[model samples]
Target: VTAVIENTAGQGTNMGFAFEQLAEIISQVEDKSRVGVCIDTCHTFTAGYDLRTKVVFDQTFAKFHEVIGWHYLRGIHLNDSKKELATRVDRHNSIGQGFLGMEIFEVLMNDPHFDQMPIILETPDDTLWSDEIRLLYSLIR
Candidate 1:
């Protein structure tokens, strides 16, 4: 099995939390070429990297590309943030109820580059997994 380092940034000093730090760590590693990122929307949004608006999305993603390269974006955690951008709080709400709405999801789904990647939902509705999953699928599909 291969170990990929995923960091949590914002509010504290975490390796993968900041795009620059994550990319820097990846660059210095011996397995730099093989290292990638698993960007959790909640973490990214909480870390002050807004993904809701196209401008913010483009700028944040551009940073990712410039630093780590898109090839290193191994996966995604498809979570919506309950807090505002740069709040540095990592609360995840259900699919569309959070601050980041369906539009961002549409963009993610339409992204051909990330098509082959895996996205996981870490919503807190444990008892409503079926409902939450269905809602997420409907939004993405």
Candidate 2:
């Protein structure tokens, strides 16, 4: 089953805000057995959750577990952050080039659980998306 919703574009609302809120709602459902999360890195960062550091990663993942456990994380959009933590900015830089850097992405890509999930890039400059994808792919084992 799929949960289709409108793209997040509203005043005072960050990209991932809807997703985060959706996660919360999904958590309350009596039958969440098939529920999962689709994380767009740009949106994730825009929502003020930094995935650049191990500490941040742990915290973010922890919050996901608290708000909506790991069983719900179904997909991921691998994009880089264009702004700092809590900036509420929605700019998406090419992978490895933004504030998130390549190191953290490499780590996430190597993670056993997350590595199996589909990671699509929503980064801009479509002409260079392939190159960015290749760059991120290279970081994985």
Candidate 3:
């Protein structure tokens, strides 16, 4: 099953808040192909991984690859955060309306890694899913 990491909101008791935790879990599994991750944009940002600019996006994802390995990435949850970076609070906001802005969404919309994966939207407004989907598709280069 794919292990979706949860944000700790600057707390310490939780184990899956970090990518390293997922890596550790994967390391213990005998059938490596059975394990994978689905990164939530809001959670990852609030957990302290930045995806703002292309440079920082590369760096943050490089770190993710280093710790968790890209092969284990099975899916993505696209949600902008109502909270700021490193605040650790998990709050879902509509795409482009929160602090995450639009560049990161544009980047991910065009990223090859996400092209084949399931991208679930966690935006607050269900009525806007159609518009959001169109907007996201428009971001593709």
* RMSD of each candidate relative to the true structure: 2.0, 2.9, 1.9
Instruction: Report the C-alpha lDDT of model 1 over 7-68, residue by residue, as the tens digit.
Output: 46365554467877887777687866666678888888878787896677888898888877
lDDT per model, in order? 0.76, 0.69, 0.83
Candidate 1: 10-residue stretch with minimal lDDT: 1-10
Show pairs that collide, candidate 3: 9-88
Q: What clash count goes with each model? A: 2, 2, 1
**lDDT value, candidate 1, whole model:** 0.76
Q: Which stretches of candidate 2 lie over 4 Å from their true place?
A: 4-20, 28-30
Q: After superposition, how far is residue 136 of candidate 3 from its true place, in Å?
A: 0.2
Of 1 and 2, the candidate ahead on lDDT is 1
Candidate 3: 10-residue stretch with minimal lDDT: 2-11
TM-score of each: 0.86, 0.81, 0.91
lDDT of 1 at 92: 86
| Predicted candidate 3 versus true structure: per-residue lDDT over 15-103, tens digit per residue | 66687877887889888867778788898888888887787888988998999888888888889989999877888899999988899
| Span of ten consecutive residues with least summed lDDT in model 2 | 4-13
